[model samples]
Target chain A: QQQVKQSPQSLIVQKGGISIINCAYENTAFDYFPWYQQFPGKGPALLIAIRPDVSEKKEGRFTISFNKSAKQFSLHIMDSQPGDSATYFCAASSEAAGNKLTFGGGTRVLVKP
Target chain B: DTEVTQTPKHLVMGMTNKKSLKCEQHMGHRAMYWYKQKAKKPPELMFVYSYEKLSINESVPSRFSPECPNSSLLNLHLHALQPEDSALYLCASSQDHWTYSGNTIYFGEGSWLTVV
Candidate 1:
């Protein structure tokens, strides 16, 4: 069974606009949520991560909003730029599971300047 | 270097041939991982090594073998791979694999492999 589900296989946004991506998980055992960014022919890099205790976390232009009760989370990019275009993946992990992460399919974002 | 390095950025091998993909990290991380990703899909974990010991094997096929010769190095040996096995191989490392909180992982540029 797929542990994490992400919506909008692809997205497009104009410069300075906000780009949003949403994800949901069925495994309540997951307590850690992280987002990763990857470019063409490159490996994924962690962008920002949040624990289940927090409702939201933000770093620079990236923000992650999480709802514990709903077992869902979303990523929001403010003032999106052209360079922010890439594939974004939402992943989850738990200490009980040896920190093995289960990832979402992915969302390709295109920012137009 | 502070980043993970993977050798042979691209490789193409025959079905009967044998090849190895190498990865190295100098970040003093004791936990290393091997992940495979296909086009338009997320990475799938294949193996995990903690403190130079094999910790997790995600039911990977017998044709794929992973080794951690040392804390700073990890290798994947491929034999008789099928065309469906062609994908991007990614290597990652983090601090000791004990704590999940405050644990950050770093990934290499990844090696693209094509099995003919």
Candidate 2:
């Protein structure tokens, strides 16, 4: 079962623009939401995360807007740069699962300079 | 440095061969995980270990076995794997899962496996 779904399998944005990716989950049990960034030939790394308690989080130019009641969340890259080009995955995990994350298919983002 | 280290960055093996992928982390984390990722696909969980003990097996096939010898080491044993098993094997570690505290999972470079 695909517990989480991501949209726009691929995205292309110009530099200095906003790159947004959306995701939704069917399992309400998911309490922790995180975004991961993966470059070619490398492992995925945690980019940013948010819990249900908050609606938004910002770290540098990366931001996560979450809606608990809607079971949806999104990642927004402000002033997107070529360096921000990479595949982004949104994942969720619940306490019951013991930290086993359910990841979204992923959104490939390319920031054209 | 906080990192998960994996060995044999790349491997090409026969279907009948026996091989092992090793991972180690030194971030004082008690939870570790093994995930498989195919081209253009998100990672899928295979095994998880908490406090050096097996905690979760995502119904993975018996051909793949996970062993956590100690708190800092985790290994995945491969035996008679089919060509479909070829994928990137990723190892990750995070804080104790019981806390319910949001812990960031860290991943290693991953071991690329090609089963023939």
Candidate 3:
């Protein structure tokens, strides 16, 4: 069973536009949510993350909005640039699960200048 | 180096051959992990080690074996593998195995393995 589901397998956006990706999780026990960005031929790097206690967390151009009751979360990149194009993955894990993350299918984003 | 390093960026072997993938980290993290990822798909957890001991195995097949000789090194031994096992193998490490609030995991570039 896919515990975490992500939508929009791929996306294209114009420079300076807002890029959005959505994800949902079925496991209510998951208390930690993190987003990772991966470039070609490289490992994934942690982006912004948010917990269920917070509704939103933003770091520079990246923003993660989470809904605890809905069990849904979304990532929004404002003023997207060409260099921001990469694969994004949403992951979740609980403290009791030894921090073993369950990841989403991932979304590839392309930004055009 | 504050990074997870994996050796042998790529490898190709026959079904009967035995090969091993190596990973190292020097960040003093106590938790290590192995994950396999297919093209355009999310990574699947294979193994986890904490404090130089095997913690989670994910019920992986017997053909794929993972070993953590020490706290800083992790090895995955492949023997009698099938074509379906060809994929990108990633290694990751974090500060602790039970904390999720402030733990941030770092991953290696990954080793691409292909079985002929």
Candidate 4:
């Protein structure tokens, strides 16, 4: 069973637009949520992360809106650029579960110039 | 350096061949993980090592053996693998194990493996 589920298998946005990707997880024990950005033939790099304590966290153009009560979180890329095109993955992990990261079905985002 | 280095970025082997994938991290992380990823799919956990000791083995097959020589090194031995086992092998690490918050796992540039 997939504990974490992500929506919109893929999305395309115009430059300077907003790209939003959402994910919902079933496990309530999950307290840590992170988003990773991966390009072709490269490793997934940590983009942004948010804990349940905060409702939202923003870093540069990347923002993570987390809803602990809803068991959901979303990633928003502001002013999307063609260089920002890549696969974005949402992951959840609980310290109780050995901190093993559970990843959602990735969302491929493409920004057109 | 906050990096996990994996060797042999790409490897192609026959069914009867034996090979190994090496990973090294210098971030003083105590937890290391091995994740297998297929094309266009999320990575699947295979093994976890904490403080240079085996912690979790996701019931992986015996054909895949994992080793932790030291705190900063991890190795995966592949032998007599089937074609279906071919995928990108990723190595990851974190500061510590069993931490609820603020634990960010860093990943290495995966090693692509092909079995014929």
Q: Write the per-residue lDDT of candidate 2 for residues A1-113, one digit (tens) a residue.
A: 89999987999999999999999999998989999999988999999999989999999999999988888999999999999999999999988775778899999999999
Expressed as tens digits, the lDDT of each residue in B1-116 for candidate 1 is 22999988999999999999999998899999999999999999999999899899999999999999999999999999999999999999989676764477788999999998
Query: For candidate 1, lDDT tens digit of each residue in A6-111?
Result: 9889999999999999999999989889999999989999999999899999999999999999999999999999999999999998888766889999999999
Model 1 TM-score (2 dp): 0.97
lDDT of 3 by residue, B31-101 (tens): 99999989888888899998889889999999999999989999999999999999999999999887554
Candidate 1 chain B minimal-lDDT segment of 10 residues: B96-105
TM-score, prediction 2: 0.97
TM-score for chain B of all predictions: 0.95, 0.96, 0.95, 0.96
TM-score of each model, in listed order: 0.97, 0.97, 0.97, 0.97
Tens digit per residue, CA lDDT, model 2, B7-85: 9999999999999999999999999999999999999989888888888888999999999999999999999999999
Error of 3 at A26 (Å): 1.4
lDDT score for residue B82 of model 3: 99
lDDT of 4 at A23: 98
Go through the candidates in order and give each one's C-alpha lDDT. Answer: 0.93, 0.92, 0.92, 0.92
- Model 1 spans with C-alpha error above 4 angstroms: none
On residues A24-96, what C-alpha lDDT tens digit does candidate 3 reach at each position? 9999989899999998878889998888999999999999999988999999999999999999999998877
